[model samples]
Target: MVARDAQDNVSPRSSTTTVTTGAACGNPVCGVRQVTTDTDIPWGLVTLPDGSVLYNRRDAHDIIQLNPTTGVKTNLGTVPNVQSTDGEGGLLGLAISASFSSDRWLYIMHTSPSDNRVVRIRLENGRLNTASEQVLVSGIRRNKYHDGGRLRFGPDGKLYASTGDAQNGAYAQDRSALEGKVLRLNPDGTVPSDNPFGNYVWSYGHRNPQGLTFDSQGRLWEQEFGNSIMDETNLITRGGNYGWPACEGTSGTCGTAGFIAPVRTYPTAEGSCSGITIVRDALYVACARGARMYRAAISGSSLTNVQTYFSGTYGRLRTVEPAPDGGLWLTTTNQGDKDSTPNNSNERVLHVTLGN
Candidate 1:
């Protein structure tokens, strides 16, 4: 089920030899088709200007390039000093520079021996220059689980990173700590001059924020995992504190704690959301336990006309990336989930075409 990376590291499992196509269920706006059946726990995906796809496998700890048209996957190289431990810590999010074509700079968030960190590397001529790795940010604590690792570049050209509380609730409330916070940094790893905290910390009091994206208006949106009661989709604001342990969803003493409430909340059973992407004015959220994609109309910070797509059709959806052709590329995490079995075709990236 698992393929090997260029370094011979075990890649993710693929589903079948042939591509599988499926009709849109309930929602008539989009149809889905399996694009590549050759990925194992693909965590992050970013498309290049030339339509090439660069992705990362969580356990594999390597960056891979996939030819969108040919289905050819090339392992660029393994990121140095990555500790892919059990649970959620490992090589996670990947983001290319705004000037990737010229600078060839790429960034990744991963777990190190001590804590989770963000590192910048050079991608030269289709290969990753591992020796060029520069640790941009470090000292964020990590645990066997709850290492929130999602990286994205905001429209302002600043690097935005999400970090989990590492199961330490107090960290979410600690203004001096990096864990359980959203950070804003320059591409070179320095704190932005206008950061609200005078440091990298932007928003705080987040539990496990896995999804981050910018709307057309440049406002940042986040999707987070809740403890047991609820899951959340939030509008991230500068210096906004989202009540984490002090607040489960909208409950608890969040209002008194000056915590920002979520735009929408779902019961944990209905949503263990992971990745998110904005397309055609709708925010598409990928769910793991819910096994569905939730599309909501975005209006400022509020979500309306919330609709569900592919409910239970795909198991444990992970990354939902916008494709070059105005569609979406969705990766599933069924290989090791309790609801599904691992197969050669289990973990797959699906192309989704939205209708009018």
Candidate 2:
């Protein structure tokens, strides 16, 4: 199969093999290869139109461009005013504008001195133009931890952002507050008129949702970090309320009493999944504490055939995205994870090829 993107650039031919029921290779993931090592918690991954990857170094506050084929890297410069909370804060998510080829806009979600915010900067001539920084959203509460930060462009050509409750669960239920909610906005930093609350919020009642992606059907899917008992993967709906403090997973009265239950839930120990992306007909999530990758077949509005892979093979997976070559690009956050011993070898970006 080959893909001709919006720019009319044709990708190389790619194919996947499906094994029969009695085949020795039961797992769809057939190969794994290390692409880059010694990254400082590569938190965000995005494949550019030119097929080069742009990723963020969480604590470093720098964006680096990597040529996937040549193994060469170039520093795209640091984002100014980005400060780390010494925990989960700093430069967190990266996304390209829909009209990137013309607009040259690159969006980022990061922690500032006072709060967590989303900003867009110019990526011109292979360098980040810090002077072109424009704040798209701000005033989000930020703490030492739980600063939910992930940015993605939905199929509707709107900017969507996931924000954490900032360690305060009460914020999750507050529609007036920007924390603990997913927000929708116009490309120019204004709230869309069609936004459910007449504000930037698209959905409410979320703890620390860190992952956002759209499926082939243009439906938005989210992955959230739970307080203690359960982590959730939700099918986002307009004006929908996902029980955060009131209900977690299916534990409380979710899917009833005006609350929406998660399509799937996992024990926190087994799935603090973060980055999510759909490749082909499957949804893939990268786990942190779980040290694994999750693959689930998307069946209509539900996810089926849930399977976990690479448990403990990678210290802690942080981000996963569709590769330009029709595979997967996964990043590890083992550097700062409390469970793992600090080691240079632990942090890496890996390429994984899967079969049908």
Candidate 3:
């Protein structure tokens, strides 16, 4: 089967017919290989137990199933009422239920006409039943930019979603509002009983958090986009406040006001970290502006042995997901223009193997 470009306008490139490995990072030769080329602005990715890889395109507003080994894609269908407006806001995140085989349910986080929302859809016989869409959570503030869109199921069996400040900095400090916060919810969209605020708000004071994942110790870790100065990787805690407008990185009055400090920070020029994933004991973060993937050794909640791979090789890495084949699958956001690799063959997905 041939691969299709983002617009589905061109045929598959002959050069991508075979998997080619690049350089070595460690003992066994860590390398990156192209899986599928010419994808639209692919945002989120989730792999099922059956090795079915699913991802969503921000502008297309559609969830697609990709055959990892064959590079064949099937459009599962579009999420209803998605607003692919200006910067950042659109169909952003996707997550499959733990009981996917039994329930065949999938969840998507998207920017609707009015606000950002999480909706549930059923996949029957490998096709999305869009007519069966169920709105799980709604009313998240939306803007032309800063619509934080990362969703994941936590170790505790709860849905955790990250929301941006929607260009409104004050929303980070407003507990009554869902903007600029990590929200915890049941699969049915109800607030979890043990949530910090007795509502869906899990952790507050964030400025467009885009990465959410759980470590080996079952602790939540998030990567947030900061202003001009710093970008943060934080160990998220229940009821913890990550000082946002009042603070940029770790410089503001963090300790004094009970705000939790980030575990690590990077200059905006070095990293505009987006998606994060844990493979074995290492945490891999995909950076958009940095055009690289960062690998850090994870020992419980602490991170060390930091290094970078594929820097500028696969322009603007957006999302990274663990492949069922013991490798990592990443998506590039090189959709053209100033923020991405110009004149590239659309955005693509790359597979990388981390050598032991």
Which predicted model would earn the best lDDT? 2
Per-model C-alpha RMSD: 8.8, 4.4, 8.0
What TM-score does model 1 achieve against the real structure?
Answer: 0.89
lDDT of 1 by residue, 93-129 (tens): 9999768877888899999988899999999977889
The models' CA-based lDDT, in order, is 0.86, 0.88, 0.85
What tens-digit string does per-residue lDDT give for candidate 3 at 96-183? 8778777878989999999999999999887889888899999998988788999999888899999999999999999989999999
Question: TM-score winner among the candidates?
Answer: 2
Q: Could you give the candidate ranking by lDDT, starting with the highest?
A: 2, 1, 3
TM-score of each: 0.89, 0.91, 0.89
Off by over 4 Å in 2: 1-6, 9-27, 338-346
Which regions of candidate 3 fall more than 4 Å away from where they truly are? 1-29, 336-345
Q: Worst ten-residue run, lDDT, model 3? A: 336-345
